[model samples]
Target: MERISTCLKFYLLEAGNDGSIEHVDKALIANLMTLFFAGRDTSGALLTWFFWLISKNPVVENKIIDEIRQNLAENASPKHIFSNVQELGKLVYLHSALSEALRLFPTGPFLLRVPNQKDVLPSGHKVDQKTKIMLCSYAMGRNAEIWGEDCLEFKPERWLSDKGGIKHVASNNFLAFSSGPWTCPGKELAFIRMKAVAATMIHNFHVCILDGQNIVPSISAILTMEHGLKATISSRWV
Candidate 1:
């Protein structure tokens, strides 16, 4: 794949400006750099964490497999594309699992925002225009005060209501893809990619964690698996 910045630069140069275009090179460069980093960096870590979670939680993986089988039915042909996002959305359990995974290990880990004017937060914390605030999404998601005593548990079902639609998590409760207009535009695409990769893997193999592997979470702007997720994949046919 061509380097993102190089491709972006080519496009920008192609769209010549005869005093009409704004000096958007710097902005485009910044945004492209963010996308490159977010796309490659967060995605890998998330998948690693996801497999690790599934390894220790066989029941979850099994449910995912069952969902895939039921959805595809007799057409177990691996080459077929599951083209409908709406149909994919019917895999409610998988959606919950992914959402729960992201909640526990938010890709961005923390959100930093500077106050434009003096204001007080809901928690009664006062801030001025210059004050920089860092909201620890990783920590907040796991906080008992925020998510209840069982916050640390890997329970995908928690994200579903009895009626079986998207549950209404508090606005501040889970901000993995974030909220409002600032929310990730690629959120749906990310879910599609994640679901496709996961469904493919589950259909092809049974995954188990390597014995005695120590996996740890590291926070450095992004939530990453410090030791990495080491697992053994045995082909399903075996």
Candidate 2:
């Protein structure tokens, strides 16, 4: 095995060129530490699962690449990809693919909550005040009753409308970001960041998972790859 790096380095990936925030050593370390838990980084885990899924589904990847090309400006070449988050929103297929990945492998696989007052759930279940309610986002996402027979399958079209637009799905049905008033406030920004990175990477490089690798998920506060992901990257332009 080859070592990409023998020492750790902070790669601060900024979304926009607006400006950079100045952070002291303590603040920077604290922020980075927040992203790690149980000795694993949540982002790394989610991305590992995403890339693993993408590798198994070549057809899906091809569609994502094709959609990126189609969304380019009329005068732009196929390789001329979106340079900002606003422009990246037009890549519908890529968005769907990402949603599909999260559906199957949510970063925060479980969400815990405590009821402020006694209430009955939609399912007619009664909850006591101050009682803990644990929602397994991972399980609900793959529920056949909610998503039908193809729930387990990686089909990005499930998120598309008849006319080829993004189909609106309730967070209840897709609890990747939770539901109702307490949903994730950074949902839109998260999507943009992911779309920006994924679009750029797929357009500029060909990512493939190495063969004979036993890829599996780990049990933790944030879902992570049991064994780290091993893959190869090569530039598409030659």
Against the true structure, whose lDDT is highest?
A: 1
- RMSD of candidate 2 to the truth, in angstroms, is 9.2
Query: Which one is best on TM-score?
Result: 1
lDDT of each: 0.76, 0.75
Q: TM-scores of the models, in the given order?
A: 0.80, 0.78
TM-score of 2: 0.78
lDDT of 2 by residue, 1-238 (tens): 0111111132233311334455444454554454333223544566667778888999998898888877767786646555676579789988888888888898889899889889999989899876799999899889999889899998888999999888999888888777897775446656766777788889888887889877777878788888878888998887
Displacement of the residue 216 alpha carbon in candidate 2, Å = 1.3
Tell me the spans in candidate 2 whose CA falls farther than 4 Å from its real position.
Answer: 1-43, 74-82
Error of 1 at 213 (Å): 1.3
- Score candidate 1 by TM-score against the native: 0.80
